[model samples]
Target: MPYFRPIALALCAFALAVPVAAQEVNVYSYREPALIQPLMDGFTEQTGIAVNVAFLNKGMIERLRAEGRRSPADLVFTTDISRLHSVVSAGLTQPVTEAKLTDNIPAAYRDPGNHWFGLTVRARVIYASKARVKKGGVTSYEDLADPKWQGRICTRSGTHSYMLALTAAYLHHHGEANTLNWLKAVKANLARKPQGNDRAQVKAIWAGECDISLGNTYYMGQMLADPEQQDWASSVSIEFPVFEGAGTHVNVSGMAMTKFAPNRAEALALMAYLAAPAAQEVYASDNYEYPIAPGTQADPLVQSWGSFEADPVNLSTIAELRSEALLLTELADFDG
Candidate 1:
């Protein structure tokens, strides 16, 4: 009897020492941690669901495929439509047909098949020198390829996803031959070889190395916030260039549920919450991005840039054309 009693007590102690797993959702993210932490904290506080994040700068799809069913990720978060499309194409994300997502996110911003949803949007705009380039000087994207602007433009590599997306949009508007010509013209106009990120182009404008460049709208906010970079930002103003008929090109930061999400219900809940006004507000104010949720306002700084018509071309159409866009860039040898 005494020996039996000791065994029972030991079992009780062991059970007490090993705590039960709490409700939580694991996230695989390409966005930086500091940018996502506040949203995660808000979700945790509101729903009592612990959120774990893994920030990956590259190879997100490969990592998920390698993990397979054992992947601990409940959701995948990424910037740029290119990456979101890659995740969907890789078959790693499950279709989510939640009304909250569908209702809040616009049709153009979410997958038609419900595979992913965009959280925020940013326009790929031109940055013209405030002093050197006159206001209304650049009204359309095609204007950048004009002979007058040759030897006065700066830009990042054409092979970059950002550039490819723009090229893809151009292809949709102007056909292959015209887009190729446009690409070659833009490349020929470069003050120097396409090198450096968007901000670096603005730095060149400040340095008088170039009078104009291409950059994203959100980066303008980032530059204005930095005292050292404010001069570069101040030297230029954003131009919402259109495709003759279509409006300005824009991209998104978005999310999706993993096909093997262990916490699907929690993941769905998180996804819905992110699409809600509260989370959209956090994304807008903190990230300086245009919220996708209808009626959700842009950050004050973003709003100050004034509104322009967004290109009405469906994002799926753009995604479908990305590969061809890359091929054209290579053919034009834009970077070379």
Candidate 2:
């Protein structure tokens, strides 16, 4: 992950010159433009308010923190619970006042101060080599730690935010010692040095470089849907493991309002709109994430993975445990 910088910028000349009350929203997002543009269009179409966006590759919380109150961003639409946690910890973001967000999003997936709210969920799932692993052989997150699976794993570095969120979840349920040991066991089983994103893991399995790897539910969706990745998708099988006594490891793409938002009401409206059923569904269908709002259902591709019990642990707890998770990751000794 890298930090984004503030390159002193002025708003549109007309926007800056216009009197207040024109109703506009400016969002800085890590989510891909194609995935969110439709929703932005919908918001503009329905509200008749213009929306400005800036697309980023994966990391901006740290950058926003550096920008401080000078940041022009009204809202930060991001993925990764750990990243959202970082933003809240820095006090660069604030809570939304809209009751709709509170009513629509669950407490577990949001911040206590309402500083951030999850828009969608992506499960940390297993993608097994269909030729090597049987359909019913693996069905839980705990299975990855078993001795029998030694030397069969392929994954990204544990230091990556993706795995840290999972490590945080394990710590939440099994405690540090047990989760630490499990991570060590998993480290010992690696077929190669950890490297690449979730999609690369699936590709590794396809190449017979490894039999299984950790994957995000959405990557599986794009792999299956994209003509270029269809071959990779075909070589693997998707699994949702409930982790023995704990819930499945899951993460999210979330939103938070900037502390110094120039348009506070517009920011709150954008956050509330994202939590609404229509926007939630758009996130689900477009990003293949499980909608954070209760009545919002997942996309068809996500539904095919089969349901499992999700870790009931509140994400704030995971945020609180980030340091511990980082330490455990270092202890695991991953580099790839």
Candidate 3:
């Protein structure tokens, strides 16, 4: 069964009573409601367009395929390049050639065909224990495999999307043979069997179970906001590890227009609004992510974590390498 949780917008209550020609947009989002509610509310307040979001934990593509031309989804909101690429590859999204979109988002962050646009960027970084790991103890992704850190790393399942994305980026920098060996070496260094979410890994560090873990940048903000997790968050410092000759590996939270959008005009308005500088600021400030719009600044808290050059390879290339990355992960029995 598809897990659908509709966000309760003020407009949603009267949506059924509104005329057929009313201005509105429907979004099928893989992101949680709390993460995007402010953006939806901002768009509605600015344009007077009713925004209805259906949060789907999984199976968004299958649900859209099942609905076919009858699907009411105007936009698809998600994180990670692979999920965005999957929607485009499934033939479920249409090309958006709006100049506002093109001008605001950099080419490296958007689909070459205009099928999707990245709103924010997050680097896959090391969360190193402040007490156990010295400053500059880890400076590169290749260092994770070094024997000196044996049984000192904590990570999520090898096949999880975040891990695979990192693995995929590794494959791009080094070919299959080297990537496989790197994976095996990293796996051998795990503190325990690959387990839990990124936050859990940080918690493990606080519990003195591991010295470092791999996670996204935004997670620190999330942890700091939660009273119980603050200590877990405080125990580690964010480390931007480079990919040998390349920069830090990064991914995005992005948006796309559905191929069968019933509210094309309204959807376009929201898309443009999101890419606008002001909206980008809101997203950055509220989510602790790096805004992708040109000249847009990230939240001060995010900036304080410092920055690094994002990997120069286009995300589409990373998406293409995901399949092979997963195959290597499984073959190595990384979880075992």
Candidate 4:
């Protein structure tokens, strides 16, 4: 009880001396909030900068353009190389010249012009029916077009951004003529019309509607986690096919600074934080994707799938060819 009043006053004074955190960074994200909130919480816990996110499933670029110069957005985060390139091409995003970002992310996953940075990578892989297809039946991207697999394959619409990006990567290594012919070949092999999402293709395989399908690696992780889709996830095994001499096709979930970033410094700090191993660990694990940072281990489930050599080509090159790829898909009447 001795000096109790003075001790209480001193504790109150210490509490009053602590600074309040007033800084915030606004984010416009195509990524779902539940998927990214943990990273945001971790960032705020470390730096005391609040992150405000607006989630958009579509029309992300259009929304930014409509907002124009006075836009409150400081950062844009989304999936696919195409979306990243689209924002830059529209001039809605500004270049980030941070050395910390460049040092943490690999050269292939980022914009050479520094306009965007990839946070995590997802590989385009083959899902083969374990009961029907032999282990070595499919070894390369070219095999999807082989006559032996005709009437045994399933896919989503050819024009979907995921497919378009894969088509673009195919165009990159194999050239237009081969790619076009390959597209037609794959179209001929479809067990049914391209419909639904990547997961639906796996469901088709489980129903014995198809023997093989093309999908992103994360979809397998997602399907496994879903109680309704566990059978579909168990029906197939993943095959890491390469592009002949090249490695597997990979796409990224990436970020960019908006052209009208009101909180540029905080945005950049967040971007750099995302690139570091600490944040990459949280972000990639949350999404079941491969970390862009070279040595960071993927989640145990993703790791159990084994690893393969990722194509050495920079993603910007694939983004450049997406339009041409989509045109070829239409010309081939791939879904028809």
For residues 1-336, write the lDDT of model 1, one tens digit per residue.
987998999999999999988999999999998998999999999999999999999999999999999999999999999999999999999999989999999999999899989998999998999999998788899998999998999999998999999999999999999999999999889999999999999999999999989888999999999999999999998888888987999999999999899999999999999999778878867878899787888877799987888998878779889999999999999999
What value does the lDDT take at residue 119 in candidate 2? 84
Question: Number of backbone collisions per candidate, in order?
Answer: 0, 1, 0, 0
Tens-digit lDDT string for candidate 3 (177-251) = 999999999988898999999999999999999999999999999999999999999999999999999899999
Q: How many backbone clashes does candidate 4 have?
A: 0
Q: Against the true structure, what is every candidate's RMSD?
A: 2.8, 8.7, 8.8, 7.0
| Candidate 3 segments exceeding 4 Å error | 1-20
- Which one wins on TM-score? 1
TM-score of each: 0.94, 0.90, 0.93, 0.93
Better candidate number, 2 or 4, judged by lDDT: 4
Stretches > 4 Å off in candidate 1: 1-19
- Per-residue lDDT tens digits for candidate 2, residues 120-199, read 88889889999999886678777788888877899998888888888878787788898888888888788988888999
Candidate 4, residue 192: lDDT:
94
Worst 10 residues of 1 by lDDT: 278-287
Model 4 lDDT per residue over 20-82, tens place: 657999999999999999999999999999999999889888888888987989999988899
What is the alpha-carbon lDDT for the whole of candidate 1?
Answer: 0.92
